[model samples]
Target: MSMATTATTVSLTSVTLEVADLQAAHHFHTAFGVDPHIRLRASEAHSTGFRGFTLALTVAQPTTVDSFLGAASDAGATVLMPAAKSLWGYGGVLQAPDGTIWKIATSAKKDTGPPTREIDAIVLLLGVEDVKASKRFYVGQGLTVARSFGGKYAEFASGESSPVKLALYKRRGLAKDLGVPAEGTGSHRIILGSTAGSFADPDGFAWEAATSLAPTPSTESAAA
Candidate 1:
């Protein structure tokens, strides 16, 4: 009898936002309607400026985008870019009270139905110094490339049940898209939940095995 070996693959199972205030972060996310999709960790990690990344939410239509943006604003998120219509779609940018930037967007310019609270996807876009190099690094860590646009962008494939998707973009370009300057220092203040293992990427973003992490937060609690 011959034994078989299987190669392990990597994927983003969840995203953990390290914040200074646990209860406050929980309350904000609960009110913003994103509590079910993310995890929270109490970290007094010294970090400042851009943090080199942004979380993006994709929705069905422009009205949905507005709905999410409104919720975020009401929850105390500072409006970085007011919701507006652009050639690609309608979207807006805001910074959470914990200092993480978020972008809510929709590809549909017109509403086909009444506004919904449904979120189609949550994307974790890392701003890296070198897109190609970072893409190669993730590929080496067992992430299959779902899409790549030269040195400008790259996306990794995740399971259908994945709570979050992963992508890469040029740091300056990402900042420009979010209507902010690119210069940032200190920690990224975010940790990725990975199926592969715990390790820091070349750009300094950290990851931990999903098995070693806490459960996803609910509207009731942020305990991990």
Candidate 2:
């Protein structure tokens, strides 16, 4: 893991969701952790079916994949797909009550007997109408391409100490992957934060570029 980064470097820290119910959305996401590193943008507009994007949570072990989903289920999250051993790895999908989709998986190739209940990382996958265009746009924005496949998917490796992994996917295919209808998602409901300056992707996911603020001294008292 990398050390904490200063405000000088513009980092994509959080992925914001335009949620209809503020309290419900906050409650559901906060369950991931006291800090899943996300921000929720409240909204009144109602959107149903697919939102054309999904958040991926990477776990450290195969058993941990199941454990995360198990805990998620216990927390009132709807299980889109139960955790099972898959060709790629042990993984499954889930949907928050607010309609945001999440895919959880572990890179651990073999099934380790027990689960650890951990979410090691979160990657935001945006579904774009044109994969090539999206790829070109991010690369043009000074983001290096970490990996690409058949022009359908692309992942950019962020050098920030704790960064939200960024990636892109084919719009319709992504909806299919999340098992949601390919319609009725009005605005994609995504808000990306970065130092790269505010802009929207070709698919309409918004990015808010933040100016780094100086670090401040702690106000708490020292105690033994």
Candidate 3:
């Protein structure tokens, strides 16, 4: 008998949120399959802050996108943008109770694939003070740039086969783009998974290297 060894790829699974109501926040994120950490802070006001980031969830179908948006609103997430048809596909945005923003979409021109959760995958869109510097920093961390435009935006393609996508955006620009106030303060209260040692991004978004001892499944997907 012959044995085959498959390689395991890295992904940024969940982004943490520091909220005043941990229980409520957890309930809200449960819709996204995220298990938030229970935390206590020195200042009650400091317990919650805008982390200057938005999550992008991609689904396999337009119907799924619609369903997810409805679910988001029902789960207490405010719809920043309603699901609609666009050049890209059917998509929209949501603002979670804990202040996290999500832009979700499905391919408009392509056929919807397998059925999964309303949010099948996530893209971490970090709003940075400086886009160019942030892009350079991630490149230094061994991440390859999938695409970029002048100093305005850049997407860091994941190394994992089905990895969580990441991107950089101007802080105020992002806030304004999302129809929200352009302000970020206090602790980010978020955790990002990274193959690189745990460290803060140029914008203070933190990342922790993969440390789980569980065996990687042979058919495990990076997108999931």
Candidate 4:
């Protein structure tokens, strides 16, 4: 491909959630069955209200959605939205004990088989002030645009080996979708692991090269 058409080769490798209490965060992830998909780091950054982002668990069907949500609740996640059918799909929202908001959802309204505690994909959606500007910033960092809807939303294409997919959405609309207010302050309390070098985006989301040092829990026991 020519330089003009060449897409950057960057891809996401890990997602680290900064939390005040690491042990509690680990326990929560363990209970929610997503410990393998995320890493936890110690942070005391002052933050309040919406954190300008959310992590979503895309599952196969409604039954699976309910199963995950139930596990999250039993693990100490606060329900933000009860699981329900929508025009787009069935899903629910919750806030983890460590203050990270998560949404469990599926496009299939009905179950095709018995329920399973399986997550189809994990998407990190950054609620940004300007989707267009953020999209440009990410593209500059070597992430290829997968699907974009003008200024409203943009999804990036991650390598098949990527542990997580990244996307951008207008802050207000995202807040509404996640059932929260659009206002927040202080650090994002999250770090992205990527092949791209370390830098903060236009909205202050941090990314560090995946090779950076840090010991995290093993993914051996978790479902992929």
Model 3: pairs clashing at backbone N, Cα or C within 3 Å = 162-222, 162-223
Give the clashing pairs for model 4: none
Ordered from best to worst lDDT, the candidate numbers read 1, 4, 2, 3
Model 1 clash tally? 0
Model 4 per-residue lDDT tens digits across residues 18-56: 888888899999999888778888888899989999999
Candidate 2 lDDT tens digits, 1-224: 11134334334655667777667666766665523466666775556678888989998787777677776677678998787776777788998777778899886788656666566778888888888899888766666788999679998876554447888899888888777767765667667766677787777778776432223211111110
In angstroms, the error of model 4 at 121 is 0.8
lDDT of each: 0.86, 0.70, 0.65, 0.86
> What local lDDT score does residue 62 receive in model 3, on the 0 to 100 scale?
79
Off by over 4 Å in 3: 1-14, 32-49, 109-120, 161-163, 212-224
TM-score of 2: 0.82
Ranking by TM-score: 1, 4, 2, 3
* TM-score (all chains, Cα) for each model: 0.92, 0.82, 0.73, 0.91
Instruction: Give lDDT: candidate 1, residue 16.
Output: 84
**Model 4 / residue 67 / CA error / Å:** 0.6
Candidate 3 lDDT (Cα, 0 to 1)? 0.65
Prediction 1 global C-alpha lDDT:
0.86
lDDT (Cα, 0-100) at 87 in candidate 1 = 92
How far out, in Å, is residue 167 in model 3? 1.2
